[model samples]
Target: MNKENREVVRPDGTTIHYTVTGPADGPVMALVHGWGCDRRDFDAITGFLPRHLRVLAVDLAEHGDSRSTRDVWTMEEFARDVAAVLEAESVGSCVVIGHSLGGAVAVETGRLLPGVVTRIVALDALHYLSLFPAQDECAADALLHPFREDFAGAMRGMVEAGSPPGTDPALVDAYIEKMSAVRQPAGLSALEGLVSWDMDAALRETTQPIVVFAVRAIITQEAIDRYGDRVRIETIELGSHHFHVESPEATAALLAAEMSA
Candidate 1:
């Protein structure tokens, strides 16, 4: 299908790339990809969608086809990019669906834009460890060390040891491929920015309705118990961290339902 494409210039002059599919009069739905992925990640996954909803997929600056600048990256900057896109497209009220790091960006976007965001759907992201604090977790920067000459080895180690069991082989291959494409310093800088932020305040300030679609096993039962009411925690049984990749059809269905509601 033909897709409409454009670039939105953010306040600071950074460029964010975006694409629109479906009908213009349809309900506006924004799809934001997670860390290390691009806007194209949303393609080839959706099964059935609401006929009246327009889908907008964004490539966050520095991650996809979007332009990267010299300024320091922050979730707030990411949110501004989202706002620019929404405004540029004349999207009055939108249903925002984000995955992983994009989930945090979705929250900030809703908080900053207020009534412009009707509902938010976060896929497989509860609280990113870097942005969200753990009660007893140490201040150790074990996950932030500089990449060594054996960086490839380090990534392999992380996948083998840190990833959940029975992860889809294709999913692993995709991650490795994209991650390899990124320079070491760029990856490290982005991860550092993510880990350094205090996003709890941001989440608390967001008043829009939120639906958090998290993998069943990644998030603890206690975490679910605390936020289950406002944040409806849905499970993707098969996928690991990349739940959207495993179940985009279901995710899209849930968002379509939210749009209808």
Candidate 2:
């Protein structure tokens, strides 16, 4: 399968960068990267997907080569960016797969295009109570305090929280450094959007089946109990929260399997 880099200009003037692979008419699967990451994160995974599947790996606004002049950083707006790419490609239907913050975007995308999105897949996303289910002003302020004071430190904390025991120290360090480099204003604003996103409300509106591949090491039973009735929660003993990147082949197999399901 060949990967082709492409860009789509939304009506809002935001430009989204994405890569497409496999046959255009094949079953569609859109890949949305997590916050502080880009579409390239799915490059390897794309390679391992079934040849008959059309994969769209997207770079959300300001996250990768995508550019946007708009100010809003809500996950809904981010989903619009994904929607733009889909519209540009004339995608009739697809399974939206998101990692971390991208999972929120996936839900928003499902809500945004209810008929177009068949199912939603979350990779270590939505289960984190600290970020999901919009926080109160006080709790939101408390979370933002750390990022405002020390962005890099806050970023490191975010990565470390996702990494489990036995994970390579070098891998953790690399993720910290990469995530810490997310461009300013957008980075912080996006985090704010995530913190304030109403997961409950979104889940209430989104009717599509959502499957979450949560890391067994970090996922809490509280989260499972909270969302299991709503979404299918499968505890996967993958590397860590960013297991897709660490275990691309296995992750690809799982995604392929999900699409078939």
Question: Which prediction has the highest lDDT against the true structure?
Answer: 2
Candidate 1 per-residue lDDT over residues 90-149, each given as its tens digit: 998898888877887888789889989988888766544433443222442665452344
| Candidate-wise lDDT, in order | 0.72, 0.94
Candidate 2 weakest lDDT stretch, 10 residues: 8-17
TM-score computed on alpha carbons, candidate 1 = 0.87
Candidate 1 Cα lDDT to native: 0.72
Where does candidate 1 have its weakest 10-residue lDDT segment? Answer: 131-140
How close to the true structure is residue 236 of candidate 2, measured as C-alpha lDDT? Answer: 93
lDDT of 2 at 164: 91
Query: What is residue 253's positional error in candidate 1, in angstroms?
Result: 1.5
